[model samples]
Target: MGEDDDGGREVYGKMRAAAALRQIPRPPPTTFQEDLMEHLPAAIYTLLSCWTRFYQIGKNNHVVWDEAHFGKFGSYYLRREFYFDVHPPLGKMLVGLVGLLSGYNGHFEFKSGDEYKEDVPYVAMRVMLATFGVLMVPLAWYTAKELGFSNRAAHLTTIMVLCDVAWLCISRFILLDSMLLFFTVLTVFCLTRFHTERHDPFSPDWWVWLTFTGISIGCVASVKWVGLFVTALVGVYTLEDLWEKFGDLRMRKRDYINHWLARGLMLIGMPLFIYMMSFKLHFIILNHSGPGDAQMSSLFQANLEGNDFSKNPLEVAYGSKITLKNMGFGGGLLHSHVQTYPVGSQQQQVTCYHYKDDNNNWRVEKPWTLPKVDDAGEIEFLKHGDIVRLQHTPTNRNLHSHNVVAPVSKLNNEVSCYGNATAGDAGDHWQVEIVDDLVFGKREKVPRVRSLTTKLRFRHVLSSCYLVAPNSVLPPWGFKQIEVSCDKQNNPSDPHSHWNVESHWNGRLPVGETKFYKSPFLRDFWHLNVAMMTSNNALVPDADKEDILASSPTDWPWMHLGLRMCGWGDNQTKYYLIGNPAVWWSSTLSLGICVIVIAVYLARMQRGYRDWGVGEWDHFLYVCKIAGLGWFFQYVPFLIMGRVTYIHHYLPTLYFAVLMVGHLFDHFVFKSRRLKDTTKWVIFGIATGIVIGVFWWFRGVAFGIDGPIKEHWGLLWRKSWNIYESH
Candidate 1:
């Protein structure tokens, strides 16, 4: 009886222990382990990057290809000169800040192909970029771990990134791409963390991850518009997360509303605020006028101290010396000189030039006589329907247009300056018609000509055509400025035909609102975004120009092309941007493997053959789906973009591909039930060996080791693998 009681009690105790284990939640890692994992990858990445990125970063001692463009922008920022770029301002601002902190004097011109002076301190800037690049590897690794990959898998992904030649090249230079990549990976990592904490909805940890994800979204997007893809990814993920919460039977109605409110504020509101803040800082810092002033409105330019528009507003009169500006997008000041278009008609070429030269100035005179001051002591303003002659100030020739076809537009009447005996003839006379509403109080019959506010159209009296600035470039004879012609059909609403007086020399009218004009941040933000979009759209390659290193998106997946970042001579120091062939091929093949595995898994499910529990497989699929979406979003969009793209553009996509490969290897090979341990080890070993060996072979290219082009060609006999042949 005593033995039976003892056995029964032992069995009861075992059952109770099992029940307790099922009830308790799986706890997170200890703080010490988390710290070790985070710092270990970071330390390794930093050490590797420092050696590869800084060893001979300044060997060439001259400006690399794109450094000229971005370096000048940094100088402009230090000098407080406003400029425009197709990308957002944060990356350039950061570069400029680093240059400033490093004691760079902002005096270098940084012109294309110009050798940097020995004292330029370009290495400091290169190191700053390298730091950002170094962070990308660890960020990718951390992101993989957050998305459920094991430490080995995460470290493998980091190794793939560190070995990529393209990533190395971009990181070792002074470019915005490295910073962009860093922010993109950081954003993904934050969003992944937020996704992982969804079980504890509305908790402080949940809000922290969500908030940081929003901040990362803003940061990434501020680097380049391409970051919008990551933003879209976050947005979609957020929606899905909230939908999942709504469907949960345990979630109360109030909890659902709270979830929506919290996410809306953090994800949408925070990023928008941060994005606008970047632009606000940009406008505040760049106070003086610079090369990009011509692209802005006259009012905005007037706010700058040194711009020509900052002068006192001039009175409008018949004989006023004025510069007429085409209101069309990217139009310039109406200009003409003694030079004629060499091709068609051969008349003196009339074009719109952006610069402030004497050739761009003209005298507005009445066809009959110069006007006098009115009884109110105000100069007689040029009114609508008044016939006038625009005399070139430097050449003393009248603006003339006839039925002759323009050099750019064969159907339009060519505009030119006539200096012969008929300089003041009726053919030179044009009717000035005001197109804007007169808004400077009532009784402004002759609309008070405000510099940017007033718009006018000049109709040729003889040719019955309206003077217009088409978006065509004139020939070399015309200094390659925008073509000015007269179209037969006049559209009052056409911006190309509208003219604004950019600079006037009347000494009577007082300048208004020069210092008091404070444009709202929202308005400026909108204008800047529009300008960036327009500039990006205009980046198509010219068919007449030959770019030997230009590549197509098709060449990116196969790693078939390379870009020459810089070179001193054929046999001297050179940097060619390309990736390790073995890694690229293997990662691409892994993508194919992912497709096959997903297909097989689905087929097995259809056949009612379950390999894992429903919950576990669902979680695994979620991770893979997010990573696959990231890869697709980063790459497939480039295929449709019409602008000029290069192999460097594929680096972001390559990052996700590496992660995808790591995930597949961990889940399919290491965790597989069917595959033997020996088979898995063999496959892993072969891939690792190829990657490391190929990277070693190409280390010379990334490290800037000087070698002859012929020798490199011999080393890489395959045409597609030869980096020198790409250029």
Candidate 2:
């Protein structure tokens, strides 16, 4: 009886093992037709993408919205003229390359709403940038597949990306948005591919994908600062992966360390190297001095071709005409304009300007001297602790500060060009206190002031305050320049209070040699990055000013606003930047649905209910985490940012939400065992049909609306949209 029972139990165990093996999924036998069918979806998406992106891309022959700014930057690149902007150089460099390839001469000034000249290759440039937008569709399809979605879900992802009117419209212009979106999608694609190769760690394919992911990250970040949001997503995924590897008991300690090292090298080190390389190329190409020369260091500007700083005298003497540059990062030249502050002091505005002009030049004179007085006395070289009056060369007004509060920095005294050179009082007298030089340390005795080398501070004689120029910007009354104030706190370490003679002119002193003004690459790199960040931060929306094109972050997911890309004249071609309603609304709805489903699954698991097998559960969690977390990481930062945002800013974030829609549909409808295959195909057909229909209806907004926008009714799905002239 015992032997018979054992035989039965053994047979039952064998039956259970066979059932488990059957549960594991397997791919069908491959054939030429099957292989072709597998790639046909992405290929079809790519062809469709080309038509949509390139169709009528050149229909508008005028500069549209931001095309004015970005296209001008491209011209600056082609002319090899140095210019400064809030973004990194990679995207603009590509723009210049496209212009070069199109035989553009970089001669046309891309002013806003200006018509393109016959010789200008604006069409070719637009088509080249639109290529980035076109590639996004196929990349999305493959990204969905790498994330372990079904073919139906991959098709859905491609359709949503391809049909988005906002992405299509922005790509049709010569702007950085297309490049930013392309690299953003490419980063995610490479990340998913790397995640799939995790089962075989340290394999060639794994390293290749990881390297590509890092390269993509660098490219994305080099396009815009917002790319850091996607990079943060990669960081979170890596941390989770490393933590899982650490928990594996079967893994050797050496192997785990190797994993960390590989990730560190590929993700951190490689991206940094690539980012720095872009800046290096930027510096190499933009070697000539241009409008932005004053934004850089005195030593840096001396190297530029058009700048005459190298011809300036090395030493500063009494009556020397000089431009005082604030030594702080992102600081500007000491400038005084004809306009006066409305509230504070009501004197001529003493501010910091980023452009070189005669207004920025000041003459260093003895406090006791009268205006235009030729002193027959000995030529004395200016030294530390010299009491001098900085007379504005153009206006002849002395640099003056008083007890009145500054307009911007209330705690500091207001600085202004108060009285004429001969009529200034004790307030105009500033004690020249020498700070340590960049090349030379503090001397034991009084050190003679040297151009582009000595750092000095101008202390108010009456108020005992230090002259300062922080990153604070003045209002329009001050010509939107940086605010200059007198700080009450005499902090010696404060860089804002440090100033150096940028351009010195004295007949007595010798010219500065080129070697004396050489600056290091790393220093210049750090300086430019800080400057970019400073200018970008200053772009906060003003309460007193109304920007019609700006939109709140809350308006993004729902498509509550649409931007007019050009004038609404009946004869002019108009483009409205808005997303496809069907795609946007459905994708946004999926984001909320995803959170609820994940919460329910977690609660069920806590109660010991099994809705999915172990393998199936892992796959579900992986897909959801990628889609859900990617959307969260990209979207949340915009909510807290104070900078002015637009509808186009959300394009990168939209890609992830679209992925969530695809994944949720695949999980519940397309790949569900409870649903018949026919039902899944029908659902897919409805979804595809709705997206296409909506895209077709709104296609005029992207392809360029010809007639009066008021005639194009029903396009304003959202009440807040300014697409129509009445609105």
Candidate 3:
């Protein structure tokens, strides 16, 4: 009986213990709390770093560098200016939207270095850009953490970015670089997150990360085409990830196809949709005409409201007042002004002007006789191969070309408006051969303005040369417009010699059907893309005269130069865009160290020293390789680019390079088994402290503090910094 009672007590005691355990609250796992704690320092540092000098962004009430370009574009959007840029429209659209919301009138000219008057509301734009700039630090910090850097290393990486003077200067201005960098870094961070969670494949959380990464990629590319580099990086990583999955023995073929389909929909389809939507929004918002109309086609211009091209397309006839447009790409309207090429033929200069003006108008006439009007108001229609004379309206001179050489094209015959006499000489006579096409087994002469395919060649009767608008700019004497000359080769197929009547007026004929109705979006999209590409390709800065602020990719990695954003009165109110020297140099050195460490690791592995634990080291090495590849793709491509690049172009590369530095320091220095924790902390502390100190010292340049030149010079350690002083 005693034994049984003891057994019952034991069982009851065990039950009571179990109930007590269940009653006690099981607090949420510390893993999430641990993660928050781990990232706490970096989060705090990023916030303080971004917010510290944020308000000071608007101190300088003036336009700087490309601020003039982008600011004007923003205003143009609000006023519905049909402008063109080499980049995609999302960044400028955002600026425009912000300006509109803030009650900005969009009236400021935003000329280079122009001071904003008291009433001009420029603060909102600057603050908005600065806000994006400040966010870069946190984005970069998150990226580093996701890439497997330790907490201290992640915090230090944020510090390096926050302390960059170039980053600060660019952020504080109304520029696209900040927005571009923000989206680009966000893309990389999201991609890292996606990669980390990719083991789950088609899980809901995994899909969300993948989708976010795709959207971020679209946003980055929408800012600048340079975002393609990030796109390539993500693309390669994804392909490699999928390839590894396919090779996995346990993975079924069906799962592989599903993975591929999922990635295709998210990465390819989603990004394309978002990118097209950006352009759609751009086309919708900018409904009115602006300065950029001249760069587009007649059909495109006809679509804009309040544009001269939007007028009725008139019929062609003798004595018609018309504007002759070049049919070639980037061709302009035939124009003549009172000014002549000072050195060339001393007659009135005949050139091609991209915009419409009184000088562009000309009266069509027979070779020597005036067209007779019938009693019923009927007039002679200008036919193919008809010899005619073009009389300049403003100058009352005939379109003439002789053996004289052109100012720009020395080999070509000079074209000018000549002859004070109404009955001009043979030099004024030209055969107008209309471009023809076979229609229903018969060659039909194409009419002017009615058919865009119509091409005309003005063959000089005496000189035996064809009127040609070369893709070259004339001298200042010719108003710096496109050069129009007479080429000896009168190839009817040459587009440069092809002419079409763009603006026509004939009293005898009624106005034709209007071609300005809304067309299909795809057709407009195709045409606009072609026009934008043509315009962008034409924007080649002269290589012989390099701008003082221009930089090359080779110069970027060495921190060899700085750009002058703006200045007033010999360095007064100067804004110099230079990276923080300590940060740049340290990051640059870290890259070299990373290379050496990687080599040594490879050597050790080749010699069969594999005891370092394969899984952890392999993961670390893989992340480093990816970060290195990102840096390479961003920086190396600029080496071959022919465009005029600036120091700000290096900002994207700097983001990845700084991440590599953080990764290197975390793995090799901070986590080194040979080094004591105290020593590691000391090293990191000194490095970060120096970077912060330098950033604070040069904070004047970033914030546009105006004072004595010597005061600013005292803070610079590199002699290249003197470039700003001389400027």
Most lDDT-accurate candidate: 2
What residue pairs clash in candidate 2, if any at all? Answer: none
Cα lDDT tens digits for candidate 2, 551-646: 998999999988988888999998889999998999899999988998999999999998986468767877888888888998999999878999
lDDT of 3 by residue, 5-122 (tens): 7755667567545533433132244698787886686577667756754747677777878989998988988888788776788999988987787677888899988888776678
Every model's TM-score: 0.84, 0.93, 0.82
| Backbone collisions counted per model | 0, 0, 0
Which whole-number lDDT from 0 to 100 does residue 182 have in model 2?
97
> How do these models rank on lDDT, best leading?
2, 1, 3
Give the TM-score (vs. native) of candidate 1: 0.84
Off by over 4 Å in 3: 1-32, 324-353, 357-362, 367-378, 384-500, 506-516, 538-546, 570-572, 723-726
**TM-score order of candidates, best first?**
2, 1, 3
Worst 10 residues of 3 by lDDT: 436-445
Candidate 1: residue 126 Cα off by (Å): 0.9
Please provide, for model 1 over 1-727, each residue's C-alpha lDDT reduced to its tens digit, 9 standing for 90 to 100: 7655775666766764553343323347669887886778778876876777677787776787788888888898999998888898988999899889778989999876667776677888889878888888778777877777766577677778878877888888778988989988888899888877776777889899999998988888888888888887787777876776655544589989988899889988888888888988888889998877765555566677677665646446765788887777666678998887786667677888766678988887767444432334646677777788888988888899988888888888999988642345677889988787323433245455655556789999988899998667654455557789999987877888988787777666566444454445665677567656755665666677776667889898788877777763665677778888876777788778888888999999899997775355766677777777888888888889977888888887887778788888889776678889889778777767777778888877777757666665434635765455534
Model 3, residue 418: distance off in Å is 7.6
